[model samples]
Target: MKKRLLSRLLLTSLSPFLFINTASAAEQAMIVFDASGSMWARVDGREKIVVAKDALKQVVRQWNPETQLGLMAYGHRR
Candidate 1:
């Protein structure tokens, strides 16, 4: 119940990142991830970090191969 909801919310929030104007000449995208300590907290019996990783994997699998992808993470260090 809660697990599904959490997953759905995460995916929904990230949907915008998946849908971009591919017609643009740049054809690039970047994912800004949260790696703060708070992400270690558990949500629906699973660590939030775990949930985020799973969600990112799904997103990457569906991502357009032609688009150049970049990732930038912050909040990992105290």
Candidate 2:
């Protein structure tokens, strides 16, 4: 019985270290968008900007809640 208890104690003490490599950090995603006037052009009866926004929304909904997302816009005149 003493051997079993000692083995359990050792296992418990080392379990964290043994499994440490399996732990993972949450991943982050950045989504960049073009805000140029060209994006406002109509395509297939829908504006390109609208289509891009809809797609981004869908992707954001599908991503894991723990994951972080950042939005950036470029191409607008300075």
The prediction achieving the highest lDDT against the true structure is 1
lDDT of 2: 0.60
Tens-place lDDT digits, model 2, residues 42-61: 76566767766665565667
* Window of ten residues with lowest summed lDDT in model 2: 14-23
Query: Candidate 1 lDDT, tens digit per residue, 1-78?
Result: 887788778888876765566677878887877798999999868999888888888888988898888777889875
For model 1, the run of ten residues with the poorest summed lDDT = 14-23
Q: What's the CA RMSD for each of the models? A: 2.4, 21.2
Tell me the spans in candidate 2 whose CA falls farther than 4 Å from its real position: 1-24
Residue runs of model 1 more than 4 Å from their true location after superposition: 17-24
